[model samples]
Every structure is written in C-alpha cells, then in structure tokens.
Target: MDHEKVNILLVDDQPAKLLAYEVILKDLGENLVIASSGREALEVLLKTEIAVILVDVCMPELDGFELAAMIREHPRFQKTAMIFISAIQVSDIDRLRGYEMGAVDYVPVPVVPEVLRAKIKVFAELYRKTRELERLNQELEDRVRARTAELENSTAKLRESEQRRSMAIAAGKMGSWDWDWISGDWMWDEGQYRIFGVNPESFEVNPANVQALLHPDDVDQLRKAIAEFNKGARAYETEFRIIRPDGEVRWCVGTAAATVDDSSRVVRVSGVTVDITERKRAEERQNLLAREVDHRAKNALALAQSIVRLTRADEVKAYVNAVEGRINALARVHTILSLSSWQGAELSKLIDEELAPYSLGDQIVLAGPEVQLLPATAQTLALALHELFTNSAKYGALSTRSGRLTIGWQVEDQLLTLSWEESGGPLVMTPKSRGFGTRSLLASVESQLGGQAQFDWRAEGLLCRLQVPLTRKTATTTATGKFEDASSAELQRASG
Candidate 1:
C-alpha cells in the first residue's frame, strides 16, 4: 500500500482538552486538524477531506452526538468514522445515542493519552486501506474498458477487409467453392452463387443439381475430368459450358485441388471458377472476319480484271494504267479495312493517301471537316478518286506544268458538296470519247454516293462539281452549281 498521510479532525469546546489530545497524537504519523467546537469541526470538514473525527460529547449548543448526526446525513462524509469523548462516564442510553449517530467507539476524558493515540491510529490505518482498495478497483475497470474497445475496433477492421476482398473477386467474375467429399456437403461464396445464376439460399448442394445446370454437350467432358480427379490419376482442371436459368450459355474454366486424410483418402476439395465467355465470343468473331476478308479480296481482283478486258487494246498504255490504278485503289480500300478491323475508314485519310501519288510538288490541297465513311462507301470513293487523278494527269489540268488544282468539300443540310477546279491549263473542250475511267467514275458517284456530277469545260480549264447525301443509306439528289470562273492568271496567284 502507498503510505500517504491520513487527516484526523479533533473536535472539543475546551481549548485545553483539544491541545492535550493534539499533543498526544502529534507523532502518530498522520495529519491532525484541531477544532474548538462541533460547529467549527463541521466547517473544517466542509473545506478538507477528513478520514476520521474525534469529538467531545459535552459541548455548547451542538455536541459530538449532534455533529456526528449532521456528518452522517451528508453523503460525502457518510464513510468517515467518529469516536465520542466525555469526562463523565457514558450511560448505556448515551452510548446508544452516540452509536446511532455514526460513532464507532467511546473514550472517557481526562483521557489516557496512549489509549487515545492508539485508537486514532487504528482508525487512520483502516481509512487508508479502504481508499487504496477503491483506487485499485477503478484502475482495473479502466483497463478492461480499453481492452474491450480495442477488440471491437479490430473486429470491425477484419470485417471490412473481408468485404473488400469479396467484392474484388466478384468484379473479376471468379468464384470460390468448397466441398466435403465424405459428407457430400458443399458451400460456395457469393460470387459462385452468381456464376450459377441462383440465389444462395434457394440452391441445394448435390451432384445432380450441378449436372443439371451444365450444358448437355459439355456434361460428358466435365464428368470425365471429375472421374479422373476422383481416381487420383489427374489434377482437376477443365473448361466447360453452362446453360444459365435465363437460357444464356457461358463458358467457365475450373481448377481444383483435393485434401486427403491420413490414409490418403480424399476428404475435401476446393476450387475456383473463372468466366471465359467473352474470350470464346472474340475468337469466333475473328474467324468470321477472316473468311469475309478472303471473299472481298477475290471479288476486288475479278472487278480489276473486268476493267482491263473492256478497255481498248490500241490504247494499251492508257488501258494498263487504268487497270493498275483500279487495283491500287482496291488495295487502299483493303488497307483501311484492315486498320479499322473491317469497321470503316476516315474519309479524309482515305482521300489523302489516294491523291499522294499524283500530287504536284506535294501540293494536293485538302480542305474539309473530318468525316468517317462506311466500308462500302470507302471502297466506291477510293475508285472514283483514283479515276479522277488518272484523267487529270493524262489529258486535263494535271497535264500542264502551270496548272494547279483545288479540291474542297463542305457538309450542309445533310448533303456533301465536293468540287474540283483547275486553272493555268490549255484551252478546254468537251472530250469526244467517253472513256472507261470517266464512265466508271460517273457510275460510282451516282449509284454509290446517291449524288450527281456536273462537268464544266471552259476556255480556261475543266471544273467538276459533285453533290452527295451526307446521311448514310439515303438516296437524295440536290442541284449542282459552279462558282463564276476566275481568270487563269488570277486563280493561279490565289492562295490554296
């Protein structure tokens, strides 16, 4: 026990008696406060924490009995022990009164100093022990509360960590399952329930139920894998298909390992299942695209052959050029198709690449907002642009050293208007012969783009205007108009 001083309050009306008692207990190894009256003792008690009170039974106004009664009435001082002292011998009735008023013992006055000091010492030691016990109890309670709080906090963190791990596994479309082979009991995580397309509570664990959900064509393969696992001849791993409750068939890859007992008999099995439906679908789509590409390549070669056969044999150079040009255009279309995975092509990029070979000093001017063209539209546009470039280089503006061409396009009211104008060329006239390239270009623009073309052969140069529907799958024609011709010198001097 920690030995701290205990406070004792001495109460008496006579100053001499108080001094005598104080002197006797001065070496008691405890603190003492002397009071001259019961009233003064009560005042002292209110200001300080007193462990024991020794009071004179005979005093003016309020005596020891009265003071003890008052002290007992207050909850704060209820535990303080009191001893009554008197010069006269205490009667049985008086003694009873003192005890009733919360006194523990009586002492006769003109008191034997040794007896008085010894009794006070005992009460002081008791008071010290009581306070020490109370402090220890409080400390114990504090430690218990802190430990309980730590346990609760740790439990909450563990639950949160488990929830996060479960959500991550579910997002990856993976499921975990456990089975007790001996008992024929099975349990599955939340993700496993989702993969089987059933509420966890509604499903029962049985071999028959599992087989019912598997695709009929894949059930035999799954059974074979399971049989091999049970025989200890192979590790469990298999890819199978399952028909869900919604009639949607999906593929799953399963891998499992078994737990054996002391005798090497399989006791349990645990495994994971991963959904592989998307992988299967992507592979199928890739095969279909390969076949389509092969067919399109053959058709393009046949079309090029037809173009060569129809052209005149006398104009061998022109015919050969036209055939090679058509084949090149088809090749460009195929390249774009491959780049876009056969989806489509950007119109601006397709036009840029086609005109690059014929550009004069790399001056093939291009002006338009970007647009994406469908696969069929891309092929037709490639052929048309190739023919235009071939014709211009052979007999039109591109044949002259001073000629310059401007190609511009705009989309307005769901219609695309593309124009090709030339200047600084030889005097122009309408061509007498309608060549294969010209006829093919006209057919491609009119039939495929659902638009019209107007050819203007002026004294200065040849200008062509094309109007096509901007909206796909629509065949709408709008009027074609040409801007007023500017002088060749003036047009050549203008900025591109």
Candidate 2:
C-alpha cells in the first residue's frame, strides 16, 4: 500500500446522516470527506483518491444511484466501492436496480456501526494492497533498467582482455568462472557455486566436478568448441546447459580468449560464465507466442472453410450471411479471450458480448455462480450461446414481445449442467431435420468441450441442456523456474 493515509468520501444531503457516518468511522483514523449532494460528491472525487464512497439513496438534486452512475463513467473511480444507504423501504426491484446501477453494497438506514466500519476497512485495505503491488512492480522495473545499463556500459570495456568482465558479472549478480588452460586449473567465484547449487565444502572447480554438472546433450558441443580453440582458433565462445547438483538445468554463455606473452606463446586461457537461463526462457516464450498466433490464424481459416462447406441456402447471399454470422461469433469470443489474456472468461461475459445487439430487458435471464472456463471451453460455449441466442432472436422466445428466456447452470462433482429454457414464445415444433446452426451447437458442446447436449422442442418453447466435465490443470509456472499445481496433483491422486 501507499504510505499516505487512507481517505473515505461520504455523500448525503442530510448533514445529520453524514455526521452519524463520520462518528461511526472516526475510530478508523482516516481522512473523511463529506459532500452534501451528488454534484459535490463528484467534485470531491475529482480532487481526492477515496477508497469507498458512502452515499445516501434519497438525496435532493441527485441521488446515490445517479452519483454512482456518474462515478462509474470516469475511469479513475472504476475500482472505488459505492455503498448506497437508504432509510426508506428498498423493494427487491429497487435493490436490483441499485445493483444494476453499480452499487457495490446496500447499507440501509439505522446502519449497524460495526457493519459499516468493517465494510469501509475492507475496501480501504484492498485499495492499499493494489497500490502496494503497483509500487513493487515499478521498483522491479527500475532495478532491471539500472542493471541493464550497467551491463551495456560494461560491454564496451569487455573488448579489453582482463578481469573486467568478472567485475561486470559480479555487479549484475551473475555467476562467473575463470579457467587456466596452461595449468589445467579451474576457479569459480561465489556466484558460480551459488548458481550451480554446489556445496562449497564438497564441490571443487575441476574437470571431473564440472563434467558431472554438464548435461549430456551440451557436453559434446562445449568440448568441441574448446578443442577448436586449442587448435589455434582466435577465440572460444559457446552456450551450453549445465545440470545443477539438484538436477535443474541452466543455460550459460562462456567467452574465452587465450592471453599470449611477448613471445606470442599461449600463456593462459581465461573465460567468464554468465547464466542466460532467463533470457533463453524469454526467447522460448516468444517462440511459443508466435506459434500460438499462427495456430489461431490457421484455426480461424479452417473454421471459415468448415462453415462454408456446411452452410446450404437457396441464395449465395444467404450462405454468405450465415457464414458471416458464425465468423462474427468466433471473432467475438476471440475478443473476449484476448481481454482475459487467453486464460479464460466468465460465461456471463461471453453471453453479454454475443447478445449486445439484442435487447434483453426482462426477456433474457441469466442465473449462475461465477464459473471460469478454459479458453477452449469458453470459445465453444460462446459459439453455442450465439447460435441459440440468434435463433431465439429470429424465430424463438426473443421474437415475441412477451416471450421470456431463462439460462442457468449448476456444478456437481466437476460437471457443469447448463440449461437454456425459453417460454411464452409462439407455438414451437421440432424441425424435420437438423440445420447447420443446430449441428454446430451440438458439435461445440459434445466434440469441442467433451460434453453432452440435448434439445427439447415443445409447443410452448425450446429447452436445451448441456453437461460438461471440468478439468483441473491449475499448474502455474513462477519466475524462479518452478511449476506448482496442487489441484492437478490432488485430482491425479484421487483418480489413481
């Protein structure tokens, strides 16, 4: 968190309620800004960084709902908590409307002092942590820049043959070692031993010890480079993998040049070893990202071809429109995946994006706990949802003014059960044969997600149910080159 004291904003036209809120929160030892109306609250918000805003629902000129809507429009207050305090009875519809308007929580009048204080404290602490993480990230970036500058400056001096390279390596906290070719002697700095996971007491800088630490695949290349240098090559340079005592392999770049005396006779061969594991890993990640981009592009092209082959219509324009709609659905899910860093996205978000053009006022209903899906599964679900939604908009529930739709999900034993039920639409009847859209929906649910899909067509409406099993692959790789996945391991153990 930041070192500055926390600040909270209280908005209420009634001075008495504002004072009462202040009295309850005064013990928290924080700065409190009081505003009489929504306009004043906006002015205060623009001036100060407040963790949470406590606004009264029934304020003159501008109420809490209006104030919250205004605040949400500004990017600065996106993360700010908005709590609406109402003394009058708040009906279910009113409370839902308040939530729909961006109220984080509702604190009715005769507010419990402890409850209000607890809520304020929680938000304040969350804001503090967010600030703290940003600060640390900036600090880390600064350190990396400084160290990179030092390395670049040292590179110019590296042209000269001396122990200067070791000095630079040490300054950058890198491992380095020197070898004497004439005497067949090897010496390593403290950093070298640390990097190799070697015990100083038992480890020695010798051919035998070094060979044991070198990976079988890398030893031959390194030896060949050295042999070429011994055969009168001007310089010796090679990058190889070294297996640490703990069996962890690391990348190292070795640079060596033979130092000759006045007689032009080889006197000694000295070199510096610097770990390039992180740099190599970065290159590997870049290659992976490139491959992924290529893969996604090909996947898109293949999907377009499949859509074209499957779609059949009396007119070419109709075929084009059908294929275009499917492609648009794919692109919409791609956008969602990009926003989520390709990890996944919530099902509700995907639905909203697909149905943004249609009006879902009281007609479309969504009910489900937050469920995060894998990127592949999310894309499949998004496409299936788009087909169902488009069909509904065209000739189903959403076609009629009084028609209604209900979409809900339940999770049980790693299986997700989703239901899409439509009612109040015109009389429905089962189609004689499957259409392209129906086939695509079934393929997405059954083939793409490895699940079961069912469709029920009744005179009243259509009901679709999908059942998919969730897989746990919660392993995350850390910066320090370690993989940890408790969930995956636990699942494996249970299955075994």
Candidate 3:
C-alpha cells in the first residue's frame, strides 16, 4: 500500500527520442532520468538509483546489447529491469540476443504507447515490491539483534547477582533451634530470630509462634514434613517460605534431627533454619537466563541461515569463500559487541579490523571521532568494509607499493559521513562489470543502513563516500584520531 516514486532511466543518442519517451512516461508519475549514451547512463547510475532502464539498441559508442551485458555484470544491476528499444528489430535471433543480455522486454520502433506503458508499469511495480521485501528483512534482522543484546545483558547481570549471593551464603551463619519435647520449651539462637524476623524482646520462641510465621502457601508443606519426622523419620530436610512480621516473604531451608533413647522414644528435636531467599531468587534468574540463551542461539542461527541463503556466487569455491568471508565479518563484529556487552562498537576499531590484513603501515591513514555504532549498524557496516578492503587489496591502492589509502569519517546532523580515497596505485580504471563485492557495499550502506554510497572512478584511484543515518546517542564528542580536525576537507589535505 505504501509507495514512493522510483527512477526510470531512458538512454538514447537522439534528443528527440529521449524527449518523446519522457513525454509518454511522464504520466506514470515516476522520476525519469535521461542519458544520451551508455557511458552517460553509467555515470547516472553511479550517482542515482534507477529502478528500470529504457535504452535504445543502436547507440554509436555502446550498443544496447553491449550496455546490458555490462550492466548485468554488476551485482547491483543484475536484477534491474532493462527494456531495449530499436527501430529495426524483426528477427527472433536479435530478440534472443537481447534477452540473453538481460533485457526484460524489447520494443519495436513504431511502439504502441499503451503496450510500452503497461510493460514498464509491471516491471516498476515489481521493483518496488522487491525493495520493500528487502527493507522488511533488514528491519527484522535489526530487531532480532537488538533483542539478543538485551537478553545477553540481562543474563550477565543475573549471573553477577547469583555470584554475590553465593559468596554471602558461604560467609553467613545458619539459624539453629532446639525443642525439648518433654518440657514443652523451645530455645532459639540469635540467627534463628533474625532469620524468622522475630523480635527477641516481644516474640516468644515457641512451636506455635514459628508455625504462625510460616507462609500461608508453605504452611501445609511444612506440616507434612514435620509429620513425617514425627513418624520415626530421624532426619529431615525441607525448604519452605517464611513471612516476616512486616509481610516480606523469604525462603528458608530447615533441617532437623530427632534424638531418641534406646527405646526409640524421641527426647528432643534440633534443627537449623537458614535464610536461603537469595539462593532461591538466584536459581529462578538462572532458569530465566537459560531460556533466554536458547532464544538468542536460535536468533543467531536464523541470521546465519539467512546469510547463507541469500549469498550469491558463480561457483562452489567462490560461494564458499563469499559465505565464509561474510560469516567471518559477522563473527568479528560479534566479538566486538561482546566486549561492550552488545551496547555497541567503536567505528574506528571496526575499520581497523577489516583493513588489518591488507594494511601497509603508513600507506593507510584513518581519522575519525569516537563513534559507537549500534549492533545492527556495526554488523552491516563491518561486512561492507570487508568487501571494500578486499577489493582494494586485490586491485586498488592497497595492491601496490607507493599507493595510499585514506579513510576518514565525521558525525554531524545525526549522520556519520565517511570518505575512502585511494591514490598512487596503477592507473585506475572502472570495471567494465561490477561484481558481488560492489553489490554488497551498496546494499549495506543504502538498503540496510538507510544511507548513500558514491563512487568516483578517477584515473588515479577510486574515491568512495558513504553517509549513514545515525541515532542521536551513537556519536560522542572526542578528539579526532590521527588528525587535528576530522573534517572531510582536512582528511583529503592530510592524505595528499
């Protein structure tokens, strides 16, 4: 039901044709981007997101088939709908060729406006649905991660409280009481009075008084245990709750032994009544934590399953490598989150870890103010960084000596903007085809983080800019690392 206008790119060499296409599509109420050539279209794609592409098949520099081939190579555009238009197309062979190059539909020169609109509408709507699905999946993943973090924190706190209670129990004394059956007299130690919340000066130490202090729910159970002891059970141990005078409930463990003469006639009963309230509470918390841990494990396994299912690769080896790399990125982020108890992770630390394998001392420069990323942000961004670093090491600045990579970020207006620039490597050239790595980089920043990513393939190197929206609480005012001012301008100057 919810929707937004999507971009539709129209590429043709003729200005008249471009105008005509625009006029026809303007009624669709979508943003139309015009390009005169395939190269121009590529430039537009690098800067903007085009949901459906309408390209003429007979351009001079790059024909429609060639252009589609190039576009299909890029993971980001692999699923993009491409409609090819040609003035002279009647052969089935040509149509087959177009389809092979990722063309969704082929339109002949004397195009029917109605047919064109209908076809484009279907593809456009499909694109919107696909993106919506992706956004929903991302939201689900983020929620699961946040919930897991909360459960983990609660589990940790419970464990700490349990440990403290255990220590106290070990060091504290137990309440002891002795009852002389023949004399009908009861004697209690100070510990017993304290455990039962009895006032030594006002409360009598008697069996009736003790029974009255028992919790209503626990009274019947205690009576049953005492009856068992009276029926020739020499030793007895039972746990029951006691209500203090002020109405506070506490758990207590009472253990007693009956002393009998040679005739097996009981003479007295002596028992120790210890306050085990903390221990009981600790056990309850431990059970809750166990259930939470099971839940967390399932969430994690589900996330891993999603990753495995969605990952794309051409061959088994490539698929394995890609999946392994992504899993490793998640694991690394998990470690970082664990260190902070899943509150978040440092941005600079994430960058460092991803780049460590390819880092070459001074060739790499990192500058950023302290920024704590939420668990979801940290995870998605870490994978994006890993792909960037892996690509750089294989073909960009980090691939060669005398090359330099500068990474810098700053927080402003509740957004974290980062810049990555590479220089001094072999003459840089834009890949004729993009791959899974590039796709991942785009998806992480744009779809997952609700951000923007820009790529400028300069002759010298590649310059990438990423801007991710941040919550107000994630950024902190701290001294910039490795730079006097962490602004983008200063970073560029420093790199130079």
Position 178, candidate 1: lDDT: 89
How much does candidate 2 score in TM-score?
Answer: 0.59
lDDT string for model 3 (1-496, tens) is 5469999999999999999998888888889999999999998988999899999999998999999999999888998999999998459999899999999988888878888888888989998888999899999999999999999999999999976655554457467789896787999877788888878889997768888999888888767866876688898888899889999999998898999989887789898888889998999998877764564455455545655766667799978977787678778888998898677899998988886665488999899899989866787678778878877887888999888999999999879999999999988888896665676567656755678989999999999999998873222234652111112121122223
The runs of at least 3 residues in candidate 3 whose Cα sits more than 4 Å from the true structure, single-residue gaps closed, are 1-172, 180-185, 197-199, 206-217, 230-232, 243-250, 259-267, 277-305, 337-344, 372-377, 394-405, 409-496
Per-residue lDDT tens digits of candidate 1, residues 73-94? 9999888989899889889999
Q: Please list the Cα RMSD from the true structure of every candidate, rounded to 1 decimal place.
A: 11.8, 39.7, 47.8
Off by over 4 Å in 1: 1-5, 13-33, 36-48, 60-62, 91-100, 110-126, 215-240, 253-276, 279-341, 344-377, 396-496
- Give the 10-residue window scoring lowest on summed lDDT in candidate 2: 487-496
Model 3 steric clash pairs: none
Model 3 worst lDDT run, 10 consecutive residues: 482-491
Supply the TM-score for candidate 3.
0.47
* Model 2 C-alpha lDDT per residue in residues 294-385, reported as the tens digit of each score: 76666666666666666667898977877788778888888888987788888788878877878678898889988888876776777688
Q: Which candidate wins on lDDT?
A: 3
Error of 1 at 339 (Å): 9.3
- By lDDT, highest first, what's the ranking? 3, 2, 1
> What's the residue-level lDDT of 56 in candidate 2?
90
lDDT of 1 at 25: 92
CA lDDT of each candidate? 0.78, 0.80, 0.81
Question: Given candidate 1, what's the lDDT at residue 461?
Answer: 76
Task: Rate residue 412 of model 2 by lDDT.
Answer: 88
**Which is the winner by TM-score between candidate 1 and candidate 3?**
1
Say which prediction, candidate 2 or candidate 3, comes out ahead on TM-score.
2
